[model samples]
Target: MELPIDHFRLLGVSPATDGQTVLRTLQQRLDRAPDQGFTHETLQARADLLRNSADLLSDDRHRTAYEAELTALSAEGEGGQSAIPALEIPNSKEVGGLLLLLEAGQAQEAFEKASRGLQPPQAPALGSSREADLALLAGLACQGAAEDYRQQRRYEAAARVLQQGLQLLQRMGQQPEQRRRLDLALEALLPYRVLDLLSRDLSASLERNEGLQLLEQLVRRRGGLEGESDAAFPASEFQPFFKQIRQFLTAQEQVDLFSRWAEAGSPLADFLASIALTASGFAQRKPERLQAAYGRLAGSGQAGVEPFLACQLLLLGQIEPAQALFEQGADPALRQWANEQGEEPLAGLCAYCRDWLEREVLPGFRDIEADPDLEAWFADRDVQAYVEQQDRKRARSAPLHPPEAAAGAGAGTPSTQSSLDAMPLWPGDPLASGLAAPSQPGQSGALSEPLQPEEDEDDWPDLALGWPNLHWQDLQLAERWAQLRTSAAELLAQPPSWVLPLAVAVTLGGVGVGGWLALRPKPERGQPIPVLPAPDGTVQTGAKPSPAATGAPKAAASPGAGAPGAPAPTPAPPAPRNLPLTVAKPSSAQLRSLLEAWLAAKAAVLAGATPEHPLEQLARSALVGNVESQRRENASRGESETVTAEVRDFSVTSQTPQRIEAEVTLRYSDARKDANGKLIASTPEGERRNTYVFARDGQTWHLAAFRASR
Candidate 1:
């Protein structure tokens, strides 16, 4: 007979047993599986189950209670009494329709319909067929329901249903499909569960107390059995799911997991060993362990070879090698060349390395290179000096760095400076002149190699990347930006008032033509506008109306209409007059106040300290400043800044809530110098651009963009 479904029984133990005992027993079973007629599927499945169950038992409460109960059961009876639970296999045809219907997302309805229309069972009297099928159907139905719930983001309900389904599937050992379905359901549910817990638990975990403890517990519980596969089920079908689990492991505190898996020589032992070694090296900052971990990956011949190779180079701190591999592997030559020219090539490699180190290596390490404790472990004085010098040099030359590179008293000392300037191609060479041994015959090329290029940011070294120095490119870019700035200033010098009205008329003409076609009547029923009405007294339809008949109103006879009922035409109404505007000229005191307000606004935007939204505050303050400055100028005060006293000939044509139009003339004398009080240029040379604008809010106006006159 097949083994019972109870994990304890399968392991030849009672429920009261501890995880350690259970684990040992399971290992022994795995070791002898080949000789015991266990298929690969069965063996792997059982191993996964054992590993997962042992992990579950690691909790203090669970372990304690489970062991106590198992011990009591052991004391009660032996052999047949404590049988491992056997899974009931459902007949293929029996649950076939149910499975398909459940797959279609109609599980509950399908189950109810099948139950109500059940046919009498043809099974033996040993067990009730109706009961067995119902149990099986109920389990499948719950899993299907859970999937629906998960899709709708009802995660808590999904988790509950999934947990129940998994339990039921465990009892339905006879049905492989049921087992498979349950595994898939759990795989899908686990990610959402982990994410939800993380959102709530991340802050607590950051704290030093029980906060991190709770997060760790939730991570283990949610992410632990993620990669476990059902033996009776096809695990390969869920490769993407397994990949996701592996990703989650990188983000959590997984040392305990790695150690346990390594000790057990589990199928994941290779990966775990790598994580363990790399983590230790990273935490300790020991390069050897880091190198060793990478070496292990090289031997694996796995598909994720890029990450492994990258890890080794990164740990060794050989950026160029890793960069070469990444470029060659991830892109075409043209794209790769372009990428190299940009910052992305090196940056991408570095980001990838950082992420891997963060995940698999010492999850706790921060600033791995500078950690003094790690540095002290390397006993070689020369290597230490070499590494330190290289780091300092790198810190100096690294692009886009903050001012930290230029700080520190000995930051640019000769010893450190040379290492930072080492040629990328000469990675193995010491920064100091440690010459190579004399070359043999036919090795003259090596001996005659030219001295390295001068250590200047603009100069190229022997390496290909260093050859096309980025400094020249940056200088070119700066020059282009300067030219653009000058062009923009010239453009802004021209006034907008003259350009806007003509552009508006042109735009309106186009709109009018388009509107005419849409608004005018179209020829319908093969009838078109005729030149005149027919000769008869009757007016023919479809004729264009004459000017007099086009709503112009008929003229009256000499004095008045002869008809007694006729009334004189009402006098035509006159068009409304536009409101006049008032303009102000700014003086020194007003100018100072306006500039002060504007400067404050600008400073606030930069500091992010402004009470109002930065841009809104900027616009409002600018308007106030402009209005105040206009007022000051109109008062004929002394020339201020670039603005001077002029013949304040200004006029306002219109002033409505939605529209404003104005004209002004401005002139100024030489203003005072800058804060240093030097002699300033004469003539008020600043240009003033006038604009008529439609306003949304009565107090604020946004300039509708218009083209400049050619």
Candidate 2:
């Protein structure tokens, strides 16, 4: 009744049509046919094609049986046979085998079986009773193969499988049920295909705008930016897509893309754009644009947008809002992004924020004891408070005195001639007595005026001179004179007898003794002592005297000690006392000179001068341990290397009478040979402050030790 139907011809496919081709061709024909008013022959042809095509395409065993049957029918047709039996589809058990393979995760095996089953037969016409069921089974097997590829992250292969299924379904145009399933599978795979293309060649995709279009489609399919449709696809799925294409997009393009997605109200789009903005070098240099995009996303109250926005705000120096966002809690994803982005300026900004919080905000919070919220906030970073307290303790412990006071205390008044002159002549002598002498009345001295006035003379005696004026009465004076005359008469009579002669004899004897002593030969002269040279090279012909003898009182010489023609021998001056070495505190000018000379000597050593050089001589004379160390270091460096040092400035940190601790800033340049002996020119410019301890050697200052400071 169906006329020897050629299923392939009816479905517009060749005899060798693959199973997918048969399914596609049959579906197309059915879809093209009207639902109503179709002639019986046309309807019958469509029905017969659906049945035979499903039978041939649904399973390999059924398709083989049908093909053999078709061959027999064809042979019968040549013989002019009138009958053609209905196509027999494989039993459920045969179809179940393919489904079992797919269900057991054996997708490749399932796909192979499905492919064989869908193969077109030699005869063009075939019919089956259960066409819809077989077609659906074939679609399921194709989806299974595609799913296997996807699970292995072989997106390209998965996409290929999905595309093949799509094309097959498209060709079988009228099979709505099978076509819909294939369409959904293909739609699901499109993003991965785009992602694969992007990963392979980002520049090509961007140039072609394929990546952008796919991203838009993905965003739209997720029910616009605002919708939660993205929950269906893992964030990891789109991560590769964004990461691959981020560098290729220009700033404006990124902004436009982000702005469009943001307008679509998709939180995922906003979040991704925020990440891209943070990752971009341009965004680091220009944060305001990023801020606007972030502001829009954050306004939407998205779960992840706040922290990213906070980071951007931090980079922009917007501390308050950034702090608020961070206080809510740090986002691990954003922190990871910040680290991997490798944007130094952004990293620096984060460090600045951390420092600011620790140094400024946290302290303010800690200081507010009355506010529980502030206290609780401070408690989170209590270590910071402890550090602050320690720092404050250090500051308090080493309170800085005024510079003037410290200098004044260290440097007493300078010795002067006036001060020497003002000293007392003897120990415990009063200063006023040594400075000025008391004068007699009517004499020119420090105090020449009389003690009493002329009018007060009668009240007080004139005792200015050694003797005082006697105020005896006239009668008393006469009585005393008469008594004195009487006494003188008595004395004149009794005296001058033995006493005068005794006095004369004693004077004569003293003169005789003196004459004898003077005439006596001096003690036998000892052998002339050998002379020894003084430290200063002066010879002294005398025995080394005891300290007491050398300090003994000198005697007065006799009148005739030396005869007219002979000269008196003079004792050699006592040998000068040996004084111990003492350290002398240098003045400001002397310190400057010492520092300048030390610097010059260092420069000389660095410049490759020999130890015999003038600067080296000066260094040896002025600097001790440090100079020798430097000289040794320089000598060890050999001739191929050269170092030059320039003193910038210096300050005295501390000073003692014996040593000075000074901080000196110096700029050094070094030139040396590499491992291959090739001369490498390198000039590293920076300031170094070294603390040098200078010990005073006599009147000169010598560098004793030196160390670098922070």
Candidate 3:
């Protein structure tokens, strides 16, 4: 019987290859076949075909005869005009019609037809490599669209496009090679997406937490900084990225997050511990944190340690020596920073260093909790908003021109079914950067008739993955650095008296407020800051309310570590009615009382106080379990918080006879103290939207499941 896919092509070996090589190749393929997410029948069929091909190719006499048949089959196949000569094209006009459009360089039309064909009624029209080919076409179409989004800096949209394609391909897992192609393209977005998240404004704790969580997930998947050597999309350098993002987070927040990671001995232990110590040293004005940081980096010889050490030295107001050390390193960012200093030297670099640590250094690192009124100040002159608005317009724009209409050299050329076959795969940048391989004679459409790919040792091209498919870029990182430097220069121009011993006046610290609220809708603040209703039922706008009025256990009264300027507030959630909720009028007072009681209990526990009488009875076992976990964590860290939970805007969405679903705006103010009872960190507030499923046990309502919004 004639082979459906030629044995040499299936094994991806030259016809002159020997039996030993064929067997070795077959074994390798069989080993990898199981993990490709193929269907059971497909796997079985593939296994049989692979074994048969190897058997037929192994014997010298049989191989000679097989090669003869393959040569004759090739001649017949060429007359048929099929690109993938190894595999028979399925007898379906639906598939043939789409392939023709793809060959014509109309990727969008090919993709649309393929998409419609994949639906229930049309999927039956496809089989074998042709089915996989259709899926590959759809994936490549997504890649083309994503590359456009990347150039426009619409990172989220680009990610969405890739993710949507991945979802579709994942469901059709029979074709492993095609699915793998899309996977690699999506992975390329890791750095760009993470950078965007880090650079975005810190408007809400929930938003910040979500970004941090997403970033961490990506890092963990890539095996963090240390283990990404073999990763398809290796992690971006974190030390400098962290340094850039740290300005948005408070010292307490930094310590709270990083210190926990360090203490837990996470994969990111050493670096995170160093950051925690650095932030703590400034927060507490304790030299011990610096000593520890020095110990962590001094002999570790980790990448970027020099820059980190230089930063520590700069923090100590060691100007000349630190500058020398910074310039010594191969860090592009530091070198550029030094060069920019020549333009506006900022009192000869001391101004920038002084602004960073004037409020630090020496002693008296008391938590003054200055807010800087960035909300009002940034609002008055929202330059970032204008720039971002322009960016949004650009992101939503149509392509500058249709796909490049070049031919000979094949730069930025699209390979559709109707188009000529591409040259052997280029080992350069994947499809996204429009980096074309050295052009050869024949070509095929990238998203439509991708078949008979050249499995080049350096670059795998089984499908016609055309230009404008990969989305990797420096992503204006240098531009961001320049912007920061410019901002620092402007800050130094004003505030002449900020120098205290080191000319450091702390331009922006502890608060990770990003460039602009208007860059994306996620961080925009359109509404007035929601006011928490006083525990006694009245709204508390200015003065700190009594324990009863603030929904705290009266016994845990402590000084409110207030902000110097008005506190930065989180936006309240949409009113309950605007949400798709089953609105029911439940006793508002009853829900409030239940929530306050739970908060009082929680605060008491964080303060290292015994849970008030009936604390166990006050909440459901699940809620109690979460509280106990928090208590144990704080205790392990030798720290505790005197927390005051102020709940407001409680809206009951849907309620059952045994339970109630509600959303409330909660502002949690904590004066975190170490085991010594000394106030080491007082962040003033951490607020988020709290969703509660208040499950009632017996007659009384109890806190059951609670989720803080991301």
Question: Number of the top candidate by lDDT?
Answer: 3
The 10-residue segment of model 3 with minimum total lDDT is: 511-520
Number of clashing pairs per prediction, in order: 23, 21, 31
- For every candidate in turn, the CA RMSD to the true structure comes to 29.2, 42.8, 32.4
Off by over 4 Å in 1: 1-126, 148-160, 172-177, 190-194, 197-200, 203-710
For 1-710, candidate 1 gives per-residue lDDT tens digits of 12223334434556667657776766775575433232343345545555555564646686677667656666655754753333232343333334334433566544443443233453323344544554566665776687677778876567777676556546444346666777776665554665444334334444322323443343344332223334422334333333333333332244454445444433244454565567666555556565556555444433324434654554454545555545543424223222322123543343344434433343322223222122133333443333343343342332221122323324332222222233232223333233333333332122223333224423434533532333442443344334323322322122221110000011111232112112222322112222221111112245644311221111111112123353333322232211111113322222222222333443332222442222332233223343344335533433223222221223444343332334332221223343354545433232222222222233333221111112
lDDT of 1 at 682: 39
Q: How far off is residue 437 in model 2, in Å?
A: 88
Best-to-worst ranking by TM-score:
3, 2, 1
Q: For model 2, how does the per-residue alpha-carbon lDDT over 36-126 read when each residue is reduced to its tens digit? A: 2323443454455465655666567876776787789779978988655442323333343343344445566555555555557511123
Q: For this target, which candidate reaches the highest TM-score against the unseen true structure? A: 3
Comparing 1 and 3 by lDDT, which wins?
3
Choose 2 or 3, whichever is better by TM-score.
3
The per-residue C-alpha lDDT of model 2 at residue 369 equals: 17
The superposed Cα distance between candidate 3 and the true structure at residue 401, in angstroms, equals 84
TM-score against native, each model = 0.23, 0.27, 0.29
